[model samples]
Target: MRRPRSAVWLALRRNPVFYVAGLLVAVLIVMAAAPGLFTDADPSRCRLGLSREGPAEGAPFGYNLQGCDLYARTVYGARASVVVGVCATAAVVLLGGMIGMTAGYFGGWVDAVLSRVTDVFFGVPLLLGALVVLVAFPSGAAASPWETTAKVVLALAVLGWTTAARIMRAAVIQVKNTDYVNAALSLGSGHGRILTRHVLPNAVAPVLAWATIAVGTFIAVEATLSFVGIGLQPPVISWGTEISDAQAYVRQSPHMLVFPSAFLSVTVLAFVMLGDAVRTAMDPRERRA
Candidate 1:
């Protein structure tokens, strides 16, 4: 008789989708960490003479209208996009998880108030909320890339936590009803200890899965904001900024738009696929399906 396989192992071995998505996401993580490995050319260095040039030896994707090497820019662009996605995801998960746990565990007026607040945020669309917040506190031209990234991440987390909170609240309510939680409570454990030591471990799985998906969502939103001319400013090398610059010269230099857009699409899809794989692995029902 064969022993039961672990969910993670089963997902990795049996699912082609998991493998493909994992591979792509890993590549992007590497790109974000060490962009110099992909290209030696400086992304910001440009020449008017080589502007809109097609593919050549050193630059595989050619040059943009601004004469910067498209290949280098695209490769380096991964850093900012991935950074914003990761930072925003972490913020949302922490903020949402706390609110969810408190509301779910208490189950009274506290729950009512928290739930209403979450509803208020939930009613505001992510992009729309982000636009308003970003406009109110716009990043200056001289702001560091990280400062600009932080501003965008803050905007996303402000409106994005409601879904995570809802998911975690539901999970906590279910988990808190279990025998183990009650036993811990009867044993004279403090509320904080019971919540952290017992309830959190089991209830956090769904939030983790959702956080994986949120990373991709945040990345796409950041790109949209940039494309609209309000996200990352000049001097920050990101796929979104590159794509925005390419739009004006689409007729003359299609490569400008194609390369960065492709990268952004692939990165977003990879995170989404990875999230699906994790969710499937965690849910036995999904495995059978």
Candidate 2:
């Protein structure tokens, strides 16, 4: 008998956290795709006449010190946050997954060398490593916004992959010893084929959950870099840059800080909840509970 097609959807529907995460992703996609449709004002262009204006009829989120519409900027900023989060997560999954799977499946000197490299990364805190990279390559030196984004993505990716690598390595090690994997090996399959076709498929579930969590971490990292004045430069709107710009006037014009912080918090929370949901759904232990 075939399983019900709606099984996964039914499971997801039973989890409110999953629903909220889906909603957040949808909102972010809309914000990223058509930021201008949400607001008339350009995020980069400043209106001298309306500088530092509080939230009003047209400007619900208010204007920044430079008089750029905060609402528009926040909406547009979603683009950077989501883009960086996704790209960084993909980088982590690809690079970390390959390194981990190779080490764990082979289980020899290969494992020792890769495991040591992973340990070295763990010894160095992720944020501190990212900060060092950002400082080394300032945003001002970038040729364009794309280049700046590339730098931020690379910095976060380098620091972020360690955890994923460790998690994936553990998963791969367990999967490599499973019945199907041994069967494949007994059948005289190539090591690469057994690892890729048999072991990786089963081992990837935990990595998927971890990758979801990594999205939130990357967003926070990008924001931290921007807050410290190293992330996405001017002419580009980012939640971190917006929040940083609002820090001085947080007391006087609370809207400046409030909106961006709220959005960033929501984005991070959404990803966290989503990661939990994925973990619960993917793990048989959690699902049985």
Candidate 3:
């Protein structure tokens, strides 16, 4: 008798980590989407009368020196972090997959050249490299938020893909030499056919797992940049910037730092846990569990 599809899903759902991660992600998605739902105050607007108020009846999370609601800022901040994380991860996966597949399949001078390029990026400090690129191109130069986001996405992607490329290259090399790939080649199949049909599919599993982990890494990088005043500038509220701004008044108004930092921490933890769950689920050893 065949097991029901629901049974399979039920078994997978029994993994506590996956459920926790899913709940966290769901909360973040909601926070990012309808930020106004969490608070009525405008994050950018300041009310002098309410400035620097501690957590109280009206303002539960308190107010910054400018009287901007901390809760609102943090909720909106989620949008920037989520957008950057998703976009950067996508850019890395696409570019890295192409480069890794080509180098691995062609293998020779092509592999050497690509490998060396990957090494160059790996040598650089990822966050610092991104900050330099971001600072070099002033936000004023960009026509719109979309333009600025595109540039940031590209910068992060360029730096982030080196690791992904290396992983994909290794996976491709192993998959290409497998029995099925050799069989395809023996049948006079074209390189393109063997790669797309027999090699890429098998090679991509590890890449998928890596990409999941990379989302959390990119989020942290974006946050670091924002904290240093190089990421998601004014009009774009990001958690890093919020936490950075809160640092000054952390002693007087700890809630300002607490709420935003909590959100960032939870979001990062969710992604990390999700990646771990995916890794375990994909592992052959775990299949028997």
**lDDT score of model 1?**
0.91
What's each prediction's TM-score?
0.96, 0.95, 0.91
> In terms of TM-score, how similar is model 1 to the real structure?
0.96
Residue pairs with clashing backbones, model 1: none
Candidate 3 wrong stretches, greater than 4 Å: 1-11, 141-143, 286-289
In angstroms, how far off is 120's CA in candidate 2? 0.5
What pairs collide in candidate 2?
none
Could you give me the TM-score of model 3 versus the true structure?
Answer: 0.91
lDDT tens readout by residue for model 3, 83-133: 899899999999999899989988999999999998898898989899889
Model 1 C-alpha lDDT per residue in residues 76-191, reported as the tens digit of each score: 98999999999999999999999999999999999999999999999999999999999999987679988888999999998999999999999999999999999988899999
lDDT of 2 by residue, 17-50 (tens): 8988979978877888888778777788888888
Residue 49 lDDT, candidate 2, scale 0-100: 89
Give per-candidate clash totals.
0, 0, 0
For the record, the alpha-carbon RMSD of candidate 2 to the native fold, in angstroms, is: 1.8
